[model samples]
Target: GFVYAVTTADLYIRGGLANRVLVIGSETFSRILDWSDRSTCVLFGDGAGAMVLEAGEGAGSIADHGVLAASLRSDGAHKDKLFVDGGPSTTGTVGHLRMEGREVFKHAVGMITDVIEATFSAAGITAEDLDWFVPHQANKRIIDASAKKLGIAEQKVVVTVDLHGNTSAASVPLALSVAVADGRIKKGDLVLIEAMGGGFTWGAVLVRW
Candidate 1:
């Protein structure tokens, strides 16, 4: 979600809609979870993240410090695999989060990597070119598999799932904040952010911070 948020903000700036944009991703998954369903409750948490995107000068080179490229993809066909069971109109109450765990894990890695690969191609940079890889904090296995498949080293990946469960929309940005605070992400660093969520939505953004 935050991956696409960055892209949306970047486009807004480029299109002259605004000189600055605040892209925010906040989720309170705990409220919607059914505690009885251990599969869902144990994996999600509340979190918020925001980043400011302001107009900036670019040198028209790889050294440019801004969003370099982005790719977003979604398929409703897989919506049933991971989705809430209720909505205001559908059930008059916020539905509990529901997911086919195996299905989500099966599709997550592939969909995430696809968009990341596309973003990397669009940016004309490979995984090795990234100084930081802040993917959505889904789980360790998915993170490890995606990075391994992309050939991004373990050192370049920023992980915080152990600390912040699955923050849904807040995943990518929350991880970014952690990495930046710890000095892993710095100015002019080529950072790649990626995310996949319950709507079967996924995206990737390559930004030079």
Candidate 2:
């Protein structure tokens, strides 16, 4: 949702459909999590985050104060790897979240880094050019692995999982908010955001603050 929100807003602005958009990502994971299932429940929390994007002028370069490039992708074949067990259409009930943690971790880094690379390529920049890498707060392992694989410096990664847990779609924006509030992200800085969610949906967005 966070990826889609930002991408959609960027498209609208570029397409001359709108000058500004309020993109929000929120989740109530606690409501659907099985409290007894420590593996899933204990790894998640409830949260919300938002970003307001408006058209702005730049020097017609990567330093533009708006979204520069984005890449969104999904694979249904891997959907069962991480998902809720029930839904209204299937069981007439909101289901508890279920996941194969090991399987998810195995593929997460590759999937996330792939889109991020594509985004960087589209923006004509590399990991070294990024001021911050705000990835989904899924876990330390995934975040570390992805950053390491991309060669992004440890100091440039914005992590908030330890402070807020995995808030699903809300992770990226929450981390962004935290980083901005703490002065880690600043005006004119190049920021890269990425996330992989249920249904095997994932994406990346590159922006200049």
Q: Which candidate tops lDDT?
A: 2
* Cα lDDT of model 2 by residue, 62-145, tens digit: 866888899999999988889987664454355778898999998899999999999989889999999999999999999999
Q: Which residue runs of candidate 1 sit more than 4 Å off their true CA positions?
A: 88-94
Question: Which residue pairs collide, candidate 2?
Answer: none
Task: Report clash pairs, candidate 1.
Answer: 188-209
What's the lDDT for all of these models? Answer: 0.89, 0.90
Candidate 2 lDDT for residue 103: 92
